[model samples]
Target: STTAMAGSGLFRLPAALNPMDWLAQPDKPGISPEPSYQRPQGGIEARAFGNVVHLLVESMANAIARGEEPDVTQWHPRAHALLRAEGIAPGDLPHQTQQVVRALENMLMDPEGRWLLAPHTAAASESALEDETGRHVRTDRTFFASDAPLASGEGTLWIVDFKSSENSGSDVAAFLAAQKKLYAPKMLEYAQTKRAQLGAETPIILALYFPLLPALVYWQAE
Candidate 1:
């Protein structure tokens, strides 16, 4: 199988993406930033905002994997620093800090969010894996969960990518459907690369986690 070739490091997905361009903006047509939580200073660039969120989540994931509890209360100062580093003006730091911190807290407090981020064997954040074509595939998060299997006997390998978009449309179903359509290809690629590394028989699950909307959208990969 191609996956087996990839596992041997002989086959990999082509290297087409730059590390800096890994994030995708959710502000596509018909989708907009959540109005209620919009930044007071207009708003930061979508990519910049996403970078900050991804960094924080990465930090939290590593901490969890290391058996350290994340202290949400202490996140404000960290958020301020991250936003400032992202070129956010100092004056808008307070509002943006709160926004980012609150989102993190919500993820920890929410059941689905916590489960997606929960510690598992070999859990890693911003994991960079090589495919058969010498392409580097960077995944937002990947973990092994023996307890959560997609089938009766198979252990589950999870690939979760984070999105910073918030859903504002009245039709929640349609909004999520659009998001899945927009991102499934990339997620599928991540799954394929992983399936090769882990073997074809292992069940791999692909997920897009939206911290802003506090939602988990996942499906099993064939």
Candidate 2:
């Protein structure tokens, strides 16, 4: 007696296909058996740290897109609040604030990071899109880069997803390569979706940006 609508909320996309989950790995062993106990009053856990960085970068990118300078001083309170919301202890506010501020500084100072956050035509942060299957996808950032060799009238469309993964291993090159491999599937989906929407004539550059490492790994989305 009921007809199913394609875009109905009930038929939402699988979370596993989300870019956020592409690089997700099993939790590493922590200092404490209880997860909450592992994050001390003066410390931040990996997920919380990643959240802080992502939020900060999103805010900064949005600002740049609007032709406004991102103010670092204004972000401290916001970062503190986000950390608290993510379960950081009240006593850890100062330490957490410094950690986030340092990350913001590092991103702003790095040429590659800055370029990723730079303004471009039709720039947007956390841009949500939908696919033909009625699945919703949220891209970390999207914009049109006019500097690219013209493949179409609008130049190149860029889809950038940010990752906060840090490497503790000795082989930095291997670490980056591994990350790209892990996320390639989801990134390809993003590129395919855009290509379907924008047509094959447009050039699309799909990239993974690791701000913490101050590195960028990118490839053409063909």
Candidate 3:
């Protein structure tokens, strides 16, 4: 197995043999239809916004796993500390902090979102996984179940990648269509990596959670 061969230290795979390399080729056709609207790549402010959201979500998930209610009020101070630690300027901290809170609140209000954030027997935030060959992928969040079927009744693993885009005032279906095209390959790589690590029989489900837009976009492996 690839994971078995990938012992220690970093090893590079040839571009031709890498699935992610193939997906990154500009000429490659996408599996999903094009989106009606194009999402702009995030700027520094946007990246900082996403970082803050991630920190807040991780803190909340950790609290939930410990059987405690997450205190939303604590997020601001935490965000400030994290930003400073990351060398991010405090100029837009107030605006971005509020955005993070709003997004978290929006996610908790939705049924699917609530379930996604709920405590699990085993859960990881910003988890890193690497194959034996040194190919690595970092997942935003992962949930593990022993016996029961996860969402979509496909497998025991549930993986989520969060998007902080404000893709509003547009058709949700159209936005999702574009998102699938943009995210499918990476998500597929994540699933494939997990499958390789866990074994072939373990089913996996990958979902894109857009907290700002408050949408959950799911894709099943073919």
Candidate 4:
């Protein structure tokens, strides 16, 4: 199996492949590698905005795990302080903080969101996975059923990747279609790696959580 080969280091795979890389069609005989395009780095304001939202969500999840309602007001100050400490401009903090607060509020109100964020015995944030050959992948959040069986189709694992695009637009259907095209292979890779580490039969669900949009998109491994 590809997963087994990856874990055993018997197969030489690319060290890392982003979603776009996985989406590329290089199998055609006439195909040539696309010219490298260096995307511009997100401005400090944008970077800080995402960082602040992520921090708020992390804190909220932690609070939920501890049986407490997350205080957005408290987190707002903390996020602002963090941005200041990191040299992020203060001008963007207010709007970004409000965005984070609204996202959290929506998540708390949505039943599916609440379920996904529910406290679990086995949960990890910013989890890292690496094979013996140093090939690696990272996930934003993961939850495993505590008593799930390792055998095929008897247990479930949930892996989430967060996206922070403010420009995803109002067309949910179109956005989802594009997202599936871009992220399907990457999510499958993450699931395959987890199966290799866990067991072949354990079912995995990969999710893309857009906190700013307050949306949850998911795919299940076959």
Candidate 5:
């Protein structure tokens, strides 16, 4: 269930749950016509798993733009703060831990503005999202196209579901369970909020990225 987490002005989402079917069999890898499910690239869908790479990059950008150090748990805040001149105390974390985090942060921010990666931005940029964008609705309920809340350029939302049985131990059951527990509630929350934001229902777009079967299971509320 999409529990309403109240806190900051923005909704506080529970820890994200990756469906078992989200990743394909690490052992039985193959290609499929699925859009978001299968790795657009390759390699057992490792990079494409939840494809949070784009988010990680964009977050780095936002952190840079803000000038606030994103090193929440830097191993060595003392040295880091000294370098940035933040004059902050080094937390209890180990020096090596801090170094690793700082390195990752540096790597992400190194290119800086050169990298503009986000679902919407990348999709529009490559023009692949158009071909990739799809609509999917909950199997338990049905909503009309007009009943949708806010929508993307394709006039809908996307749930890029990935399914991996090889990694998850059980394939079909795991994938389906993920769709219901992890993806479905999240999609509903997105639909509800988009509608609230735009003051109207926007078509819901759900894309299930299944790497095991190499298929993108799509659903829409229309």
Candidate 6:
């Protein structure tokens, strides 16, 4: 069955996206230096099932990074079985990601009211954030790692990292916290530049999306 749904059998969807682009920061978008978050929001395509899309993208990227074409038409099934073996077969990936996106879209900058921060892409895993020396520092390394607007309509933005996993042998909260800690410095560094460019306030938000258990954890930066 080509992307057929029979109570969900883990078939690869027709869209096999390469996630490598996300791993390495692409050229920042063209922002007119406004009083906003720095990471420039909303340019990537965001569908309802964003995490699924991210999964597809990461799978493709991993393959292509090794110089192989990602054939989603016949790879997801094998991946699914691996998840099952890990004792984490979650049918919630799609909907959970959708809900997170909706919530984020509704999130507004505090005190004042503004809603333009858009979450265009999903990272699918924090494993994507590589250091300058190329050290993959993220520990959660779960599923659906992404960045969204920090609810501040204005420069220097914060990234929202979503952790999606079945929790077979993992602690969701701990994983979430660790990712935040690792990214805090990076977020600040990004804010420094963004604020300078747009005279925007530095990022004042941090978030985590747990798609498997349908949980969202966030903090407002001071």
Clashing pairs for predicted structure model 3, backbone only: 3-132, 6-132, 6-133, 155-203
TM-scores, each model vs. reference: 0.73, 0.71, 0.71, 0.70, 0.29, 0.31
lDDT of 6 by residue, 1-222 (tens): 011111211122113333234334443334222211112222222222333333443454355445674453454454444333333326743344444333322222221101111222332233333334433333222212212222312222234443333345566666556656765665554334323432443233445444444455454434
Give the 10-residue window scoring lowest on summed lDDT in candidate 1: 1-10
Tens-digit per-residue lDDT, 1-222, candidate 2: 011111211112222333233222233333122212121222346668767777789889878777898997887888888888888878877887777777788778876678778865566666656667767666777776532322222345678877767678887778877888888898889888776655655566677777666667776666
Among these predictions, the greatest lDDT belongs to 2
Give the Cα lDDT of each candidate. 0.64, 0.65, 0.62, 0.58, 0.33, 0.35
Q: Cα lDDT for residue 91, model 5?
A: 49
Go through the candidates in order and give the C-alpha RMSD of each one to the true structure: 11.4, 13.7, 12.9, 12.3, 18.9, 17.2
Candidates 1 and 2 compared: the better one by lDDT is: 2
Model 2, residue 220: distance off in Å is: 0.9
Which regions in candidate 3 have their CA more than 4 angstroms from the true location?
Answer: 1-41, 84-91, 145-155
Tell me which of candidates 1 and 3 scores higher on lDDT: 1
Sort order, lDDT high to low: 2, 1, 3, 4, 6, 5
Candidate 5 positional error at 213, Å: 5.4
Backbone clashes (count) for model 1:
4
List model 4 lDDT by residue over 20-134, tens digit each: 3322223333322322111223776666666666666667787889999877567667766866765665686677667766767777777666665676536655556654345
The TM-score, computed over Cα atoms with residue i paired to residue i, of candidate 5 is 0.29
lDDT of 3 by residue, 1-222 (tens): 000111122222222343333223332232222211122357766776677677678777777777897887776677777656655667866676677788888776766676777765356666666654566456787775322222332124677888887766567777776787898888888888776755554455567888877777764443
Candidate 5 weakest lDDT stretch, 10 residues: 124-133
